[model samples]
Target chain A: MALLILPIIIPFATAILSLLFRRSAAAQRAISLLGATALLGAAIALLNVVWSDGIQATQMGDWPAPFGITLVADAFSAIMVTLAALTLLATVVYSLADIDVRREAFGYYPLLNVMVMGICGAFLTGDIFNLYVWFEVLLIASFVLMALDGDQAQMKGAIKYVVINLIASTLFLVAAGLLYGLAGTLNMADLAVKLRDVARPDLVATVAMLFLIVFGIKAAVFPLFFWLPDSYPTPPAAISAIFAGLLTKVGVYALIRVFTLIFVQDVAYTHTLILVIAGLTMVAGVLGALAQTEFRRVLSFLIVSQVGYAVMGLGLYTSGALAASVFYIIEDVVALQCLFLVSGVVYRLNRSENISVMGGIYRTYPGIALLFLIPALSLAGFPPLSGFFGKLALLQSGLAVEQYAIVATALVVAALTLFCIGRVWSDAFLKPSPAPGSAGVLVRSAALSSSRAQMIGMLIPVVVLVALVIGIGLLAEPVFGLATRAAEQLWSPSDYIQVVLGEAL
Target chain B: METILAFVVGGLFAAGLYMMMRRSIVKLIIGLALLSHGVNLLIFTAANLTRANPPIVPDGAKQPLPPVADPLPQALILTAIVISFAVLSFALVLLHRVYQAVGTDDIDRLKPVDE
Candidate 1:
């Protein structure tokens, strides 16, 4: 339990230190790196502890449950925190070379550290209202990061991003307020216990529905997802990669935690809505990807599509399905970050994100192309990749539930994902250079100069992430076992509530 | 009283949504402000609108008491108000920057090349 809290505390303290030493770029970088590395260590230690000791919980300030905020670390949150720590560490390394270190010294490292703290806190928090505070922490950090450059594209994207999220935050607050009003407590565990015994069950259902809306907007579900594609690609690659890899997953994690614990009975209605949304999200996202001619835009759209798979697993509501959803979330985050990193390298090489202006790069940068291809293929659900296993698990669960239409739609969408990625691969790597007339129109071709060090910095992380994806694919049984345990824990609700509110409650 | 508050907040919410859907950046900011107000009110109303006294205990009060406003909701709303103000100011600066860079407040005009 003590180890579990370190991920949140280390980043938070480092954020303050970084701000205090904001005038010195070197100090800021050192503090940020030290903080991130410490968090990585803490996450590993916590994972090891959980592996040995089952689950861990800590009551803040030594207060009993229903009165104090609690931090709980189970298998699901532990894995997520570990992944988030690793991703932030990689992004920090990438930012060292990518960002203007001196100009960004005051705000960049501090905000990033705070964002990581927010993500870790959200993952670990056991109280519903405290989760809202964590969400605000994440949001405020992200708002600053998105507008970091103050460029036209970033400013436009930031406006839409902030507005949409503010609305979602408002909805979340309303839902939390209602839940507290009804249950007479804001702790998630106590609410879960009280909710199960409530006489006015309809009110609980209504609040749950509102929560779904709030989290759905954050998670970028179908109708609520329009802002994502427009906004994500405009930011700097490191910021975009972290946002792509971790932010929405936090929302999905919240959905899984809340619905599975407190709103199980409403699943019949909610899961159906989720199923419909999943199918549409998958299809619409891939269609958007297909229509895109730019590398980053395509990846952004694909993120929408990939998130559908995680939601699909949850919507199916079987134990197998929920486990698969967890697996999908992990794989998607790793694979998506790899893709974005590779896209950054590609943009650096070609001087543009437009696929039309890129060709024959494989001749000069075969290693980078290979790195990009791994995640791209994995994303398409290719055999022997982590993405394949995630989708297969989802398909099996959907079939078991006799959701034939969803299964069929998923198959088609998977094929479309492959085709879209293949289009990118062919245009950006395999094809000959464009004709001279077309080549002349390309902007700043001089920017295509590639450095071995930059490629190494980018490619190493991509290769390691892809390798992990493949490893997870091969070791699906054990991974699935962990996810199954998590899903079972989610379904039971008793251990979580008891740990937070005491067994007597 | 609760139903009327809901109706008013819902109306504000709908107006905010409509304004947010517009392409004008200024309207979007106004919309967000309205929406936050509506949400704050919604959270306030969720606590059932207490009257007669503040949540603070009087000097002569005993261990237990009734007819007091829920302090939790008030605290949450206060925090939310601070957060929304920060976000609103940030949005205002961002909008100002966007206007200068793109020379237009229309979102449609500011579309990036890759978009």
Candidate 2:
């Protein structure tokens, strides 16, 4: 039980300590960094335990499965917990030099830790209501983080973010209520068995649609992603990096969990809709990126586009496809965060995020430029990076099923993604600095740090993440193997239920 | 009661949606508040309401008495109410901060500020 709840407890405890130390920014940072390290340690422990022990679950207060809240960490959930912790670690490391004193005093570190708690909790919970609770926890923390600085842009973005997510949360709440009423239970494993035996299967499908809309908004699928690009680009880059890396992926994780675990009865309708949305999300997000000149905005759009790949895996509903999606998310969480952090570095160096106005950064900081190139190319699905193998697996799986239209859409979007990435690279990193009196000309020289220590504080996390992006790519076989095993677990969810609800159920 | 509540919920949702689309930040917050109320009411209504006594176990009783107002929906709605309250307050405070910073409640004006 301690092993199961340790991920949540560590962060929640860390957050409380971080908030208490908010007066001294250095203390807060140190506390949070320690908390993040502990969080990572706990996640690794949970992962190890789950690996050797099969699914580790502890019913809260020992009330047994269907009655009490159950925290369960299977291979998939354990992987996500570990990923969330790692993202928290990177955000803590990167924020040291970036997050200003005022924002730090506003308890930014605590909010980030709390948000990580919510993410890991969402991943590990075996009860649907607990999932909703965790989502709200993360959403609330994200709202605070998104509006941390309370500047015009941050507030404006946060308003849209809050309102839209409020709508989605309301929808989620309604669905949860209705699902509970229908099945007389909100325990996910129990509901899995109970939903299968429900009298009105169509009602289950209706509730399933509600879930799609809810998770769709969170996942920022096609036609539901307006809030993401609007909100994501305005936050501080460390905040944006964490948001870009983890928030939507939590939604994606929820979609995968609910769709694969509980709502499989209507796969024909639900999965096909997911596939369609996946293709459109890819196209829409990349096209949106192409039209933008802002660094974080382009990255935000790519984040949306990449989610489509994960949703596409869910849409394919095959073990191979699902495994690919799992691998894709892990790859994305690492590299996308690196890119966002690199954008921060870009802005930090040149005092601008407008790629058109950004130049000579590459001239001054070759290391930073290299940091940008790795994730940028990886996100563009360049060969020998993590994204390449993930995309290849997704493409192979799609082709195996002969989903030509969606597959073709994926191919076109991939090409467009590369084009957009190239556009960013050429405009921001490669092109010569524009002359005075030129369009979007910038006079700001690269702020080669007066404080090299602060520069290293920010730069090292990006470098570490860049190394990770390369590491996952080079070690693809073992990673993909783990993903496949996780996928196999999803394919046979009965074992999950048996573990949670026991054999009789 | 359920029938009346359903219509009221729909009305609130529509009104909230309308207000949310307005260009004013204050209106946006109001809309969010309305939507919050609407959703709480929705949870109450969607779960098959009953007009029975409050669900409290009697002395020596193993479970709550039958038809005791289906306490689960009430419990769910209670939680929703608390969460929505927290969110609404935060939204309001955030809007207040925006107004103080930008000196405007108009989202159209705030639009350019984002860039």
Candidate 3:
């Protein structure tokens, strides 16, 4: 019980302490780092406990099952919690050097910690309404973080982000209300059990559609992804890295949770629709990435595109497919974040975000070029990398299910992703730097660091993440094994219901 | 009362969506506010309103008496109200900052981040 809530508590404590120490940048950074480390420790503990013990559930104030709010960690929830914690730690490490003092003084660390709390809480909660609240918690924190710098681009992007996400939250609230009205319960496990017996299948399907729309918007699927690319790249790279890494994945997680556990009755209709959306999202996202000349913008489009792969796993709705989705998310989170931080380094060095204006990175900074190449190739699904295994699992599962159309689309998108990545590499790294007085150079070159210490501080997270991605790739078998176990738990909703509701239901 | 409120809720939804469709940034925020109100009312209506007593336990009673209004939706609404209020205020403040930064109330005039 105590273990389940530690992830949330540690971050909240850290955020308050940091906010109190906001006047002193050093104190705030130290407090934030300590809080993040504590969070990672708590998350790993929860994961270990869940791995050894079947599933863990704790009711708030001992109110018991359906009557009280519950925090439950099944295999899937535990893995997500651990992944979120890991990403939070990496983002904090990167922010040490990437973030400016002005932003740091303006409560950046506090907001980041609070956002992590919301993320961990979202992953741990067993109640549907609690999940909605957690989403709002993270959304609010992200809104401030997105606009923390208060620049023109940031403000414009923030408005679009704020408005669209608010609309999605409102819709999510409506869906929660309607589900409660139908089932007379807010507890997700209990609702799942009760919804199975509800006589009005059509009404339930209507509510399911409402949920799909809500999560779809949140997940940045197909036509609903405009706000994502518009807003994500405008934030500082550390902020963008976390957002790119976790936010939409949370939406995908919610979609998977609800669809598998509660909305399984109409899989023929809903899952097929999801598969169609997945195909379009892949094609559209990669095409958008191919069109972009900006560094982070290309990566932003890839986030949208990569989500399609995860959603495709959900659409396939098999244990293998679900496991593939989980693997894809874990690998993509690590690789994409590494890419974003590398983009930050590149921007710092070249003093430009436009790939057309940036050049000679490979010639000038071989190590940075290598850092970019690893994740870039991984994201492009090259062999002997984490992404290759993720794509292989997804493709194999898609083939086993005989989803030929989506399978073909996935293959085509893979090729396009490679081309897009190759284009970025050629323009941003391989091309020789334009002559000193050339029109292509928008700004003079800026050194990544004036001192060795600052450079190492910035490089540590990027290097660690690169190693982690490589580790995930080399140890794909064990990681995929864990994912398969998580998928099994998701495949069998009865286990979740039993653990969450117990004898009370 | 439910019937009338249903129509009122529908009216709010329509008006909110209409307002949101306009190009003005302030109108969009107002529309968001209206939309949330509509959702709250919908929750209340969907939970089945009653003219019965409030859900308070009487002396020597362990649970709320039967023939009382459902209290859960009210609790849910209270939470919804707080969250939406916080979000709305933040949105308004964002609106203010955006206007100051961009020198316009027209959302259409705002450029894309890449631009």
Q: Could you report the Cα RMSD, in angstroms, for every candidate shown? A: 2.4, 2.1, 1.5
Q: Which is better, 1 or 2, measured by DockQ? A: 2
- Which candidate leads the pack in TM-score? 3
Candidates, DockQ: 0.60, 0.62, 0.79
Native contact recovery (fnat) for each candidate is 0.63, 0.63, 0.75
Comparing 1 with 3 on lDDT, the higher-scoring candidate is: 3
Question: Could you tell me which residue pairs clash in candidate 1?
Answer: none
- Which segments of candidate 2 are over 4 A away from where they belong? A436-450, B51-54, B61-64, B67-69, B112-115
Q: How many clashes in each candidate?
A: 0, 0, 0
**What lDDT does the true structure give each of the candidates?**
0.84, 0.87, 0.90
Model 3 vs truth, CA RMSD: 1.5
Q: Report how far off residue A381 is in candidate 3 (Å).
A: 1.3
How do the residues A432-487 of candidate 3 rate in per-residue lDDT, one tens digit apiece?
98666667565432444435676678789999999988899999999999899899
Identify the runs in model 1 with alpha carbons over 4 angstroms from their true place.
A435-450, B1-4, B7-11, B18-23, B52-62, B66-69, B112-115
Q: Which is superior by lDDT, 2 or 3?
A: 3
* Cα lDDT tens digits for candidate 2, A41-122: 9899888887777887888998888888888888899899999989999999989988877888778888898889999999
Clashing pairs in 2: none
Q: Which candidate achieves the best lDDT against the true structure?
A: 3
